[model samples]
Target: MRAYERLLKYVSYETTSDESSETCPSSPKELVLAEALVEELKQIGVADAHVDKDGYVYGSIPATKGAENEKAIGLIAHMDTAPAMSGANIKPRIIKDYDGADIVLNEKLGVVMDTVTFPHLTNYVGQDLIVTDGTTLLGADDKAGVAEIMTAAAQIIEADAQAGEGSAHGKICIAFTPDEEIGRGADRFDVEHFGADYAYTVDGGMLGEIEFENFNAASAKVHIKGENIHPGEAKNKMKNASLLAMEFNSMLPPAEIPAHTEGYEGFFHLCGMSGDEENAHLDYIVRDHSMDKFLERKAMLERITAYLNQKYGEGTVTLNMKDSYYNMREKLESDMYIVDRAVEAMRENDVEPIIQPIRGGTDGARLSFMGLPCPNLSTGGHNFHGKYEYVCIQSMDKMVDIIKTIVRKSN
Candidate 1:
């Protein structure tokens, strides 16, 4: 079957991950898709295919006779969608030969994707685009990648079977991981058992993005306690924790936030906050491409917390900070050849390679630190994790060809 068909099938399983869950997969529904993938893998001639207890699916396409000595390479994509949006009951619509105009997702609700909001729509004017209704996300983030890899694997398996001995290039390993949206996708990954010299995550955007570096990330939480008193009798004795929370937020640099930063610049993003007069809470995510800057950003938060405590009687404010992942550039520097292979593969297929640093983290970033030099490849998706999410069918087909080219050229 074609990659687009497979993608539509995969997205129908409602695999949105949960961030608050403590389970390995983070969500029980992810296993439903994992088991389906195992069945598909076995049907495609990958005899050793199975889903681990943690909901990670692993499969291998063994090398043909004479190519057994070639190094094994892995292809990976996550199975879960981000928890930021609803992935359930997704109603996808196909636009054949897009007209480069505003797309009306929900006519009654007045949900429209205009040119002003998403300029990238103009780029795919004459292509087949798969989009979603305004109510639910399309789940194209990594489902497109999953479909591309599956289609490529089927082709490789068929070619090798037809040619018999001494025909295929090398062993190709494929893995479908869960909970990447919550940053636990690589926590239990078995790199040694995967047995690949290198790997590529088909988990990027656009048609030719090849990313090896990503942001160094950390999460921070702030809790504040205040002395609440009746407003009518309030004087200097009353301390409002909600007002203190706002003051703490004001202390951060106004320009150094996610909305104002781009490229290699760093930012402190306030993801959520809730509170009242008695107590308040703040949640933030700090990110930077440079380790020194990353550390400085975290320190700045701690410094702010210290000053607040000193002013509010030493126990009014508390801070909790923890590192999530680091930049993969330090680990990938020695393995430039892996990046070159992907670039060459893209160029060979008439696709221009756009090499850039990722503003966000991927499963490959954490896996790289764990003894695997993995880079990211594009899955032909755009505007991921929202209702505007979409993928180009032609671009997905090109990605399948690029994966095949990478495997053939690497061997």
Candidate 2:
């Protein structure tokens, strides 16, 4: 099947990940799509196609004739859609040869994607654009990547069959992981079993988005233990933890935040804050590109706990810090061909590569730390993880070309 058809069919599955769950996949619905994709991979002539217990589908296409000894190239995409929106029964619309105007997604709901709000729509004039009906997310965030990999795998096999001896290709491996939206996609991933020299997750945004660098991440959870006393005479005795949480937030750099910083700028974003007089909590994710800034972000949190302890006795503020992921650029820089191949493939296919540091983390960021040295490629998607998500069918077709080029150009 074509990439567009594959995307439409895959999005039909309600594979929304759940962040609250403790399971590997975090949701049961992802298995529905995982099984379906395993069948699809086997139907496409993939050998040993199967979904593992952790809900990852892994398969391989053996190298052909002269390319048998070539390095293995892996292409990966996520099975679960983002947990931020609904992925149930998505109604996608195809606007053929778009006229460069506002797109009305739902007539009765008055939901539309205005060109004024999304000026990027102007770039897709006269191309096939697939949009949602404004009720649910389009799930194109990674399904577009999935379809592109599947289609490219089929094309590689077809080309080998048609070209006879020397024109086949290297070993191609593909995997569809689950719960990537919740940051657990790589937790159960078996890198050694996948057996690729390096890999690429086609999970980034836009057509030419190539991400080699991302923030080294750490999550901070602050717990404030307070003494709730009578409000009548509670000047020095009534220590409100809620007020302390606010004070903790105030200690961070006011200018350094996600909304205020971009492009190598580090920031401490307060994702959550809650509690009352007795207890309070603060959740933050610290991000930075530099190791020094990354360490400083962690140290800043530690300093806050120390300051609060000195003021309100020894064990008042408790901090729990956990490392999320690190910058993949350090590992990716060692082998720059992974990025160079993507840029060359985009240039050859009439798409200019947009090389930028991802403001957030991706599955590739963790995969790189896991010894794969993976980089990220684009899925030709925009406004992802929400109701306004859309995918360009023409760009999805071009992504197929990019993957095919990567397959043929593998050294």
- For each of the candidates, the C-alpha root-mean-square deviation to the true structure, in angstroms, is 2.6, 1.6
Query: What's the TM-score of each model vs. the native?
Result: 0.90, 0.96
What lDDT tens digits, residue by residue, belong to model 1 across residues 285-325?
Answer: 99999999999999999999999998987989999998988
Q: Which candidate wins on TM-score?
A: 2
Best by lDDT: 1
Residue ranges of candidate 1 with Cα displaced over 4 Å: 164-167, 225-247, 274-279, 309-316, 409-411
Across residues 1-411, which tens digit of lDDT does each residue of candidate 2 receive?
Answer: 779999999999999999899987789899989999999888878968999999999999888777778778899999899988899989999999999989999998999999988989999998999999999999998999999999999888777768754346688889999999998999999999898887899998889988999989999999999999989989879989999888888999999998999898999999998899999999998999988989988998999899989998888899999998999998888789788877887898888999999888888889999988788999889999887899899889889999888767454
Candidate 1, number of clashes: 0
Model 2, poorest ten-residue lDDT window? 160-169
Worst 10 residues of 1 by lDDT: 161-170
| Residue pairs that clash (backbone atoms under 3 angstroms), model 2 | none
